[model samples]
Target: MKILHRQRHDQSSSMIFRKDYTLLIIYLSLSLVSGEFMTAGVVAVGSAISAGLLAGFNVINCMINECCTDRWVSTNYTDLKLTLDAKLYGQHLVIEPVVKHLKAHGKDNPSKALALSFHGWTGTGKNYVSRIVAEKMFAKGMKSKFVHLISATKEFPHKEMVPFYKDKLRDFIEARVKECPRSFFIFDEMDKMPPGIIDTLKPYLDFYENLGGVDYRKATFFFLSNTAGNDIAERTITTWTNNLDRETIKLKEMEEVIRLPALNNKSGLWHSELILKNLITAYVPFLPLERRHVKQCIKDGLVHKGYYKSEDEISDAKVQEIADELQYYPEGVLIFSTTGCKRIHEKIDLIMEEI
Candidate 1:
């Protein structure tokens, strides 16, 4: 037998042990009966045949166990739609493709674990979308042990630490997938990640065999970043200024628009071929929220605060007033919310205090 690493196959030892025990039983039974009826040579040949059969059986059994174990939650498109629709608003373009890709991947003959990159301005629901996805994928949601949330700064703040971080990243992913192949790794703030670090993950993201003893195909990866936020925001503003329907925005369009900026951005991972290789399943762009979208956020905040009053009570006027209070860049043009929805709760609380 070819030996790769003893420690690596430690998890499969249980199945191997059972197979050996079964083969031994069959061999002993065959030897006992053939001893009297047949010659010693015949018995030995029979034992060899049984050993060969054991190898075949072991392969089948191992496959069965692998299939049964680490089965991810099979969520339907309708279920995902309901879960995301209730929480996310004004993201029809972002939501539709995401649900479609997820549904396709969750079913039989599933492709590589859905790798998605969320880009746009801060607080444009990138993180929120990830939370909803995690919640729907597992019973414990983000709290699930299989779900790993990594902040770039906390994990690898200094550039010098990239080498160590790369090893730890590979080990962490390998160990977790070994425990449960259906693992979700969310790497937040990819824009702040050091150069060349994202490249270390290329192998795991590629479509390949698990001959290395770790299969990442069933493992999902999400990278959240604001690297191409400016480009995204500019496109959204152009769409709005031109009175174009936002629903027409396609992933292809967004990908083409964001790719160059991300590649050029100093604080970006686009320089990594892994990103340009189209290993990422989707470049889901979270569009910059207009005043109306911000108002929707404020209304959601009110409902969360137990203020389920009429629309008049939480009037558009009041919502607009609070939105106007938010600081925006490019002084004259109100292109995007500087804080996005990050400070919506605080603004709502202040508005209530004044009332």
Candidate 2:
């Protein structure tokens, strides 16, 4: 996995017999030794049976805890998305590289356990990517039971659940992730999953550390959160480098990060240019599109009110004006309400006055 990390660390289970178990052993032994001959015999018989039951329960509990702890190290992650790939952030970007890489080496990847955490702004397609991974697993005839929706934001009791998350959440997630052969669990808006989930998952975003006995290895665990930073590279390249250290590879990773800028960057100019090239110059497996059609996208969809009604109707001067106007008052683009848009319009009037 290009994004998440895995290390060869000792996956050990501590078999601690609780004090209660010791107390039970003592009580049963005393009961067996201190009664009248016949009474003692019967008591001894019952005590032996009780001891066996207690041991069984203790063993079962120990097994459960250990299994949960090591889950992160045991799960197999195949055909998963992990990289600073541009398609994720750009509109009409090619999906072939991710799919091609997986197809080429999904089996060859040596790591038995893999985890993927995908985060972006609202409606930025994290869920869509998870679904695509699930479908790919299905195509390969892998038994992948991908859990598409995890409303951890509302359900997880972030405070009281800290120990629970640290002790067992990863195992629980990975268990559900691979109920079949290849499973995935997508946690959307995962930041709100109590602070514990964030702290625990930060490693997946940043680096590979050998935290002993951390479950969450199974299937591919995807954390979808809204992240804000000027550099999209932080999400992809620096993710691994940041956790490791101030190494030179960190710079190389920067290259990866730049390739996968936040999805928002892809929707505007550069994305339009790519789509135009595919339709016009490159002619790479897609129907050719007129430049007017591309211009029309900006005119109708981008402009708030005074957009050119037709694509060809807009001139270079008009497009440049719109770009400049939007960039000058960037906050106006996110204002969804009439109140916000009206304020932006007032700002536009001020700028026009200057012009």
Candidate 3:
């Protein structure tokens, strides 16, 4: 009788284990389905359900909790820093201080929002860096609802559209920031924006005594343009000629150089009091990428397109040839790539077509 009872007990334990395993599989399936539903914005409680499933009982629950709990969420902590240092070929001056400021603000010490203005020639990693910042800061990156990307030229190109654009922009900023103070507002092609258009943001940008309504201080803004492209090119060329490391150059060294060109130019709105008064934070300069940097861009482009063979398939000789064929600015000076990295995809396509 005792032996029979022990066998029954062992069988019962095995059945219970199997049932738990089955339940775990069901929960995982539900989690995946819920994620898809959440992405469609159809189910309001889908995300909560998914989170509960993740936090639910499973054999690997402890491990999952240890790994996923705020690990991938914290971008300003070390993820952004790591990505900037590792992936970006140049421009430490832009990376260091920006990352520092972002990390500081992300922490509990409530400070004013960061306002960064990227000035350089087209394709010098200005847009790339902004996308990177958005990616690391939020799970969905640029796709996040909180990330408001406004293409000035595309949305508000004509003079007649200025008033409508201004009203829309103001309403968007106030509503978005009211919803989430940590929102990222990226204004691309700022050089194309008409005068007085940016000034609409002045009141929100100004420091306020009352922290009660629409505190823009907690919102980050990125203004990208080719306003100071020439100045940046000149400075980079000078550095190269003088045998100095361009990467080691600091923001203080080039901010004045970039600021003057942008502010004095008829194209940009930097002369406005909002900018001249220093309401805008750092002016990040992206230096011109040299031959080697161009080669690196080619390699990255190839890898992005699934052509990962470095030794035989994507040869250095081919990359150098492509770089040589690209037109450089200052016509024959070879100082900087005229298009920067803007046309790299086209070049890559040409090479792949040959293959």
Candidate 4:
């Protein structure tokens, strides 16, 4: 009798395990069909009336991790703003419009792919801002399969290869958008791109519901170039000499300044139809970093490198010591860092070695 009772208990446990496993499979099926957790919840709660609460929780967890929910492509404007404020030094003009445009794009269905052209001297936070934007929008950040960063000089080197590059570029864009509607493409060193190749993106950037059945309007493209760096720098220098606050410099003042030159220059945007059609949404200007801002960068670098706990912990003398190591421009007034925070980490590494 004891042996028979033990066998019955084991059978009962096996039955319970099978029932729970079956319920989980059903929940996943419902989720996949409806693309919603609420639908799965209804089915699981109603069908698995006797299943343990642990099983229900497991179902929800799987849906969140495996499904294309808010976890994959949700935007957090607050985090973007806070990160820009904390990590990016100076460039007060950048924070507001960037957040505003991204917020607007996040909330509404844009008619065209949002295109932003970043113009500035090197290391003035253009690429830095792009990375931050990607991180805030996608769960996987820069490593996200949906985000594509391509360099013109590296990716399309020869002028004779323009035709080949154009076809490949178009095909890649189409494929990426088809796979993920909210894809991001960053074209770095836009100035180095062979002139006609960039115009290939014109169709994707224009106002269209879909190109070849793939909706490109939900995508975002960023063009990073030094095309208008000299013009932007001269404007900033004029503003400083006149004793006007850099914050007072408006986007309107810079847009026209950059627009004419970007179109006329021998770089990628030169005579490109994207410019002629006015497909680009905004021209973001990054100002050259002043001595004070470079000092801040140095201090931040020290904290980031783990040499100090915080910016406040680093002494002014030490910060100044590193700042002095970098060459500044214009000779007489020494207004801006010649490299604009580029190669800062290398400088920090060298300084630490000396110590």
Question: By lDDT, highest first, what's the ranking?
Answer: 4, 1, 3, 2
Candidate 3 segments whose C-alpha is farther than 4 A from its true place? 1-75, 209-212, 309-313, 330-335
Decide which is better by lDDT, 1 or 4: 4
Candidate 2 or 4, higher lDDT? 4
Instruction: Give the clashing pairs for model 3.
Output: 113-217
lDDT of 3 by residue, 91-119 (tens): 77778877987776676434466778888
Q: Which stretches of candidate 2 lie over 4 Å from their true place?
A: 1-97, 139-144, 198-218, 229-355
**lDDT per model, in order?**
0.74, 0.39, 0.71, 0.81
Best by lDDT: 4
Better candidate number, 3 or 4, judged by TM-score: 4
Q: How many backbone clashes does candidate 1 have?
A: 0
lDDT of 2 by residue, 1-355 (tens): 0111123234244234455666677776666666443485677686777779786865666354422222322222343444324223332222443344334424433233333334333433455565666554543221222333556645465566666655465555434433432344556664455543434443322222223433322334455544332343233234333554222333233333332432224211122322222211111011111122233333543343554354566577654453344321124432111121113344444444433
TM-score of 2: 0.37
Residue 279 error for model 4, in Å? 0.4
What does the lDDT read for residue 167 in candidate 4? Answer: 84
Q: What is the lDDT of residue 164 in candidate 2?
A: 66
What global local distance difference test value does model 2 have? 0.39
Colliding pairs, model 1: none
TM-score of 1: 0.75
lDDT of 1: 0.74
